[model samples]
Target chain A: MSKKSVPVVNIADRLAGFSELWSQKTVAVLNDYEVKLAKLRGEFVWHSHEDTDELFLVLSGRLTIQLRDGDVVLAPGELFVVPRGVEHCPLADEETAILLFEPAGTMNTGDAGGPLTKAAELVS
Target chain B: MSKKSVPVVNIADRLAGFSELWSQKTVAVLNDYEVKLAKLRGEFVWHSHEDTDELFLVLSGRLTIQLRDGDVVLAPGELFVVPRGVEHCPLADEETAILLFEPAGTMNTGDAGGPLTKAAELVS
Candidate 1:
């Protein structure tokens, strides 16, 4: 079915339904890109998507993206785009919900090898 | 500067800062795509982007995307992606703030041209 005919994807309800932390669930697909949601706490490993740009939209709580030079802190309704090839780490003091947008088939941890790296899963 | 080193783009704050209606302002750029914000009301023209998909995430108020077969109603924190080549129109009974994701240089009105057709503006 066409995306326009699909059911509306509710961000909060979906986030609340998921139990895993730092594991991204693909909620929607927009052409070549995918919209994923995740709950985060503590710090994610420093990684970079060499060929893809990643967007982080904070749905709730606060998230800080630490870069080599500086860190960008996003509030509940804020967002930041990590440019392609930029090494950065996402950190949060408390539980934070976020929506991510990036090309389809993008690995969450990029080239960084670690246990936190995961293949994104589609959640209905 | 890399996006990770830049400032956070707050969705609500940027939406409150704008005075125009149905005009989209780019808040962030992610590779070939852009994250945009806009305030919408009334009904928009029926049009379709032949080559690009469009995403609508409602921040506040309500929005209905009228498609060829049916309509998808979106509430706060809800989102829907209009697939490429699908004819659709967005409608809202009250003022609604939204975030749009699409490729750069995408025209607001798509193939069907009229006064509402506009070039997306960059807010920052």
Candidate 2:
């Protein structure tokens, strides 16, 4: 492939560009997967992706992935992948910066569509 | 579906278990992709994945990805994705820890497989 300017995405810089809660901004793309940054401070809608697994990595603060069976809490530098078709609700006590990875076109709301459901936008 | 224990991967915890240079340890899996942690101190062979894009996120220290056109430098909290079929080399001045995300079976050496090529093994 012909080369062009290679850009590096700084997580902190991208996080500084947006402050909306639960809004995800795409920072980069890998193959068919999209790398997203989001800030969450409250509980989000319970949802599940039927076609792809979703990866959540906490960049700052703490995040809790609430499942029907139990809750999996993640601290900074921690990550968890919610399996496909599994229901999960993500919440954060304080404003938490997170990195999400899933296939392109994967909706943030998954199967449960509501007001919180918004398409991820490319930040840069 | 019935649920079991949810495992959260701590990047630092997985990184602490391995010290070999260029050896990548799989920390988690998302869909058919693998998240790997690797410790590197020197230059790596120029290689390119013919079938998948590769993401390199710096966790600690500095990493410089040398491409045919230019080099993309990454610091902690920074990431860059080298497009598929682009020949590049990864190097670090000091011991650097990086998180790599790519297809589950993607090799470290890609099309330039040699002694540096090894199967990524799951840890914990």
Candidate 3:
């Protein structure tokens, strides 16, 4: 495979370009790479992907990944990876911003039904 | 493969646990997953891995990934990936902290022989 270059993106630069909450906007793509931004509030739907793990990195505010066993709270500069086939939901008290990295074709809301299942195109 | 649980580690907790600089310490492992910490200063040796690409996420201060063409500067809460077979090095003005995610056998200084090519065992 030929070497494909992935552009260097700054979170502050991307955050400055958009402001709406809970809307994940793509910043760059590297082969199967998918990076997105979303401002989350209240609770998200519990969902799980049958394939591929999901990486969640908290950009600002607090984020909690609720699982069947327990919940992990992520503060600013913290990260958590929700493994494949694990049922999880994310919640935030106020407006919380986050960056998500996953393989292409991974859903934001997993298999659960939710109003926030965004089918956003990858933005270059 | 049975589901192997990997402990969720907080960066602040890990940073507080260790004070020595430039030493990359392992916190958790998920199958082949390896997470490390390093306090960088000055310029690093330019090298490249023949295998997996490397992920760099800046924790504090500034980090510059020197490429053959140009360098990418990463501030706090920013991330960049150095593709496999691409020569690169990390430089810091003062003492800067960073978190790295790569496969188990990925080298910190790549193939370049350096004093910081630590063979330290992964801490549990």
Candidate 4:
């Protein structure tokens, strides 16, 4: 008999390990869970999901998560969670690398109208 | 009735906003949800919880999360999850600032044996 093993993938290795913008690439998945990477810039459309919260972690640059009320700014090494049903938008002043964690079917821009609605799929 | 306002406390402000290490400080609590900060260095003892996974986000310096079989190294801006019932330890090469998210009653060192068992409490 053999034991199943989980591979150790360095996230920095994976992100710096690739070159892509606004496109998320899967790095690891555990028990139906996944870790993904994305490079973003400029501003994202305002939107909100009806069912799940989304987590955003800044890797290299500043990121701002704007809500209907105000905004939360995340410098490098910071994280913010956009709770479900809350309208929000993500903006990056310049090129930035970020990591996102959510359920498999989560959308990039929730319910607000925008041209950047990304259909769910396993990329990378 | 006056609109009940939710205060916005900058986490970095609350953290660098103070100088303390290994002590979790409450930054914001919403819907029974709280965000805390801890400054850790050296190595932490191995431990695990019977329920609930724990999240670690490094703010400065480098951090490593060790498991029974392997380990995950997190550079600044990286994030990792330690699943329930899994034995693990945290190590920092130098003084590191970290943000943690979990339920109200989650412990610092989990169930493993060592000198760093932190009983659940709100410190901030």
Candidate 5:
């Protein structure tokens, strides 16, 4: 593909353009992985990816990844990686923007099935 | 490992604490990939990853990825990925902080092998 075929994405601009809580939009693809952005608020269900690790980077506001053992709190510009098979729940006290890096086909909700589970949609 | 075992990384904080141009420091590991931070200024040797695609997210300042066909310019909060085997060189007129995601063993210099070639080191 030509260079023009690849789109340039501004994380903040894209996040500001969308306002859906817990919905992830794939902004770019790098080989087998996808770069995603989402708005998060409240609490998500407990879940774990048995085979793939999940990466979370806070773009704005704050986020807390609650685990059975403890919580990993992330402020703006902070990031954390939840190892594979480790169950956890993510929460944000306020509306927060986040970036995620993970293998393609990796479910956002992982093994848990719930109302919040949705496949990621590609964003231009 | 416990939640405490995994270090929480603030991208801006880590980038601020270090001051080495073109050197990448691995901050976190997620599955088969490594999350890295780096400071870029001036120009880097043209190279390509034969096996793994490279992801670059600009945290501050601006960056230009010079490709054989065209250039991809990224501003703060923007990102671009150079597909595997695509020769490219990255440049930044001013000091720039960036986040990188790629397979653990991928080299920064790729097949071009030059003075800038170096292995990524793990950071706390």
Candidate 6:
């Protein structure tokens, strides 16, 4: 029933460990999904996940998910899901802490990949 | 690109809408997984989801996930995943608010269906 010590993912504690903007750190794994935390600043590359929907929950500051049709604004304790195949660009006026729930191998920049496109690094 | 108006799910606002203990309400859905919020008080029936893992993130108060070998206690801003097929019982000494993430249609009392067994109600 047990493997290692009690596995508790402290969101705040994990966020405090890193400061790199736009970089996501995997905090926990639930089945095939990965729970990730990232600090966002300014605007990100416009991208669209072709395989799965991406969930973004703002932990601190504010986030605006810019879509082709509209912009979805989220504050602390708020979340939004960018539907799969729908192009979206995430931006934040201030440094924003966010929780991302997606498949394990999801890339940061979907479809369009360039400098901001990178893999999520495991934190703990 | 657009479905309706803004689809932002505010966790605190949704939590305030319900007060039924051990009952979960779906606030948002991403892909096939449903994000649910539940208020817990006292002990829940020991159960296990044989097919998928269940993730529990404590939003308020404390929660002790009693496992077969050990107990995983979580506070506000903390999360833990009970692996698939692992029997566990969740209990809270005080009123607890928790966010649950699992596949849609997953039962409340998993393998064991009793009085606590029910379906998650969708909220807004």
Question: RMSD for each model, in Å, please?
Answer: 2.9, 2.7, 5.2, 5.3, 2.5, 2.3
How far in Å is the alpha carbon of B97 misplaced in model 5? 1.2
lDDT of 5 by residue, A1-124 (tens): 2345457887878887888889889999988899999999999999999998899988888998998888898898889888899999999999888999999888889999788889999988
TM-score of each: 0.94, 0.96, 0.81, 0.68, 0.94, 0.96
Q: lDDT per residue, candidate 1, B51-74, as tens digits? A: 988999998999999998888899
What local lDDT does model 2 show for residue B59?
A: 98
Q: Which CAPRI tier for candidate 5?
A: medium
Interface RMSD (Å), every candidate: 5.1, 5.0, 8.2, 7.2, 4.1, 4.1
First chain TM-score for all predictions: 0.93, 0.95, 0.87, 0.84, 0.94, 0.96
Task: Indicate the fraction of true inter-chain contacts that candidate 6 also forms.
Answer: 0.66
DockQ comparisons of all candidates to the true complex: 0.54, 0.54, 0.22, 0.14, 0.57, 0.55
Best by DockQ: 5
The clash number for model 5 is 0
Name the lDDT value of residue A98 in candidate 1.
92
lDDT (10s digit) by residue, model 4, range A1-124: 1222433445677777667566777664533445678888888888888877677767788887777877787776566667789987788998889877665556677777567777544543
What docking tier does model 3 reach? incorrect
Query: How much lDDT does each candidate structure score?
Result: 0.89, 0.92, 0.75, 0.69, 0.88, 0.93
Quote the positional error of residue B70 for candidate 6 in Å: 1.0
lDDT of 5: 0.88
DockQ of 2: 0.54
Error of 3 at B101 (Å): 2.8
Give per-residue CA lDDT, model 6, range B1-124, as digits (tens). 3433777999999999988999989988889999999999999999999999999999999999999988898999999999999999999999999999999999999999999888999989
Task: Give the DockQ ranking, best first.
Answer: 5, 6, 1, 2, 3, 4
Give TM-score, chain B, model 1: 0.94
Question: Worst lDDT window (10 residues) for model 2 chain A?
Answer: A1-10
